[model samples]
Target: MSRFVRQSYYRHVYGQPSKREMCFDNIKVSASAWDTNLAAANPKFLSVNYQASGGGAFLVVPLTHTGKLPDLYPLCRAHTAPVLDTSFSPFSDTLIASSGEDGKIVLTHIDEDRLTAALRLEKPEVNDLEPVLRLSGHVRKAGHVKWHPVAENVLASTSLEVKIWDVEKAACVVELPQQPDMVGSMSFNWTGTLLATTCKDKKLRIYDLRSGELTSMADSHTGIKGSRVEWMGRLDRICTTGFSKFSDRQVFVWNSGDISKGPIKQLTIDTSSGTLMPFWSDNDILFLAGKGDGNVRYYEYEADELHYLTEYKSSEPQRGMCWLPRRALNTQDCEIARAYKVTNNLVEPISFIVPRKSDSFQADIYPPALSGKPALSSSDFFAGKTAEPILVSLDNLSETAAPPIKSSLYASTPVVPGSGAVSPALPPSEPPAPRSISRAPSPVSTKHDPLPSSSPAIEQPPVSHQPPPSSIVAPSVDAHPEQRSSSSSADVDQLTKENQELKDELAEKDCVIRNLELQLEKFKTNQMKIIELSKNSLN
Candidate 1:
């Protein structure tokens, strides 16, 4: 008999879909043919691509405002064409960016107070929300917009080329080399140093943002449909979702260290016509929500293999889907992640929870999550400073502490702490190395340090017309020559520590390989027994 042991704490996690009255109804989701997620959400608001007659617009609803929406509600109408994609800033609840067919990106600031008041009215008056800033540079229709995970007020928009913008200064800081074809999706690594993009060319490209250089490009899924790429945090890998040559949905895991060699592992999901949108709940759990499908399948990535977890199925098909930030998760209910599914006229919230009897905080399931606070300013990041994300404790984050949504719509209200409430601190050990890119001959050099314990209080300049520097340079050393000896000794000690860490990782991998071999042997023994039994029965 084959004896298999399951050893994951999150293996029992299941999804709980919100009821009809709890979900936002009467939403006019966009009918655009663009293969993009039309919805984006944070702790405070949910922005959905709105279907309108003229010009592009998206509805920004307060999280608290649930149930049937008013017929004539306000919308963020800043684009003259149909909007393709929208992304909420990781560092701010009120700030969001939207890209449209107008070849422009609009940065909108949600007036929570004003929007809440309008939603409360029996006969809501018509009001058009305006954007705070507009970025116009892409000559073609911008299909996607993503905010930097670890930087404040920094956004990336994809058209013919990828443009990195400083939202505060209204400037394009870095424009990556143009893609061979239309970009389907883009994902930034943990430290915001490398960018992974999937294009219509059926290829994946990783860009080294520091030098504005193309790191590695590899053939991805071969199907004609769109593909999406996501950087798996801390794992030093990239997971891409697309279709196989036979049009079967497939997931590929590629080594970030060297993507040119191709994906390390590939698996075929069922033949679903809809594109699979991949989202990482944490570093381990991956949620795959297929557009036009009602089921969302999740998997746990471990030992270089994606272990199948469980699937959440619903009868209502989703046109688009978006995930809520980790900081906004309801820890009291053992909720691991939350995804908002956009149906025809409704936006539903699906909470992935781990069933637990205790009311205490589950620290094993909830590690330190990446806080909304940025690791470094845009200026400091561009100046060659590499830092890990500032992590925060989820222990104090309770359902009662969630952001107050004032609408009469639902039962339990969730709250998000203000940005100022975040503690700027780094973990004890150095986090995984920031994804570094390499050219043919020389590899990209990156200095890894746990992020600063405290955020710098420097303010960014209003205007920045200069293009991004060609290369990132380290900070200047002190002129005092007497400190050289001490610096050399410190470097030696750090190198020794890193070497030991590498050795420990290698040993752990070896142990995993042995365990897998033993399991394979047991499976073979079980197969033999079944074959012998069948032969005896035939005789």
Candidate 2:
């Protein structure tokens, strides 16, 4: 019989299990801009709209490894009006495009290092970064700009009308005339063969890019005007949102295969006061919707379940939010997620940290006699001798054995099963016949002593088996010698250098302070002497 030591029981209770934890960091950008837009290059770099002062500016900040933001790069400074929308080129990492209220769309290639140094310098020192191409054709503010997903040089801008431009040729490729109201949002399918636009007239229209013809048009929201339209990840599905005060603010997911038909899934929002800002993830498995109530809700498409995973509250209403893509960081592929908010005078962007499991540790050893114990099998360990022992019978073993039952060993009295039950026992069955009895021999007869029985009779034992206690050794916690030596040596050297530098600085300050004190004392002495001379002259 094997016995478990008390130390093992305590180890099971106090040991730290593997856990997943997450932390969040925020970055503030562009001072006091009410109308702003944001975009990112795989979360490593971000571009935000600085829509104050005369025209507006674009601030590009680097997401540092320590979760802090470095200085911003001011890109695309030629617009004479507030930038309405900005987007990073999906085809190229270095390219960025922006549209302004000045009715112009500008494309620029950013030099990240030079921009970072310029923003760190003092004000009035302007950087020479300029846009590569600037197109001006729209009569009103270009409310939205989107890059063609498949084509490299193809771009689209929407305002009063939707216009497609070939950036390399510096000319408009095609133009689609709009209805009475302005076009609010525009997006292209993954293949760039189809384009979808949402108009203020509460209509969602899809166009065939090859022929430049109106393929299909559907009335998305009856009472509310359409605000945005997004093509759900390479699929034939598209999502659109509406903006209205009295009407219900809702999102409609439609199948692009037949655009004239109504939406398949209509997600409704509370018509209180908040606006729904929807962002689709790359996998299309999840999409996040932010509301004016300051909650970020996540919805899975397949399960049709909306999980309120996380939320951040703001005193002011939310403006907009978007997700960054996955990229390589220090040779490892990682996804960096971020959300941008424009609330009151603050422009804040929040990022999330992915939780990871703890590092591996040494495994505990068990004795050979008890090596067949099951690890983490509470039923096998807790059940008494009455219960079947399948694990021990099968000889299954693991490094960390399950905890044994201690109550059975320490309890003085055992509780019998079905003990205090009422009623009487059933009638006993008939007994079996007795075997034939052998004749007893005369006492002290030396001739033939009856041979002693070969097998001895053993009585049944109790359920609890108390085994001897074994010495329990705790795991070592000391650091390795190499690690300790290197840490101490580095710390000593750093402290010595820092101490010398501090002493030099302090000595210099002390000299300056002593000089000032000496000057004050001399001035006081001169004043006292003059007072004495004046008194003598007066006498």
The TM-score leader among the candidates is 1
Error of 2 at 230 (Å): 1.2
lDDT of 1 by residue, 365-393 (tens): 88667777776776566656666677777
lDDT of each: 0.76, 0.51
Q: Model 1: runs farther than 4 Å from truth?
A: 397-539
Q: List the residue pairs that clash in candidate 1.
A: 402-414, 402-415, 403-414, 403-415, 403-416
Over all chains combined, what TM-score does candidate 2 have?
A: 0.55
The TM-score values for the models, in the order shown, are 0.74, 0.55
After TM-score superposition, the amount by which residue 312's alpha carbon in candidate 2 deviates from its true location, in angstroms, is 6.2
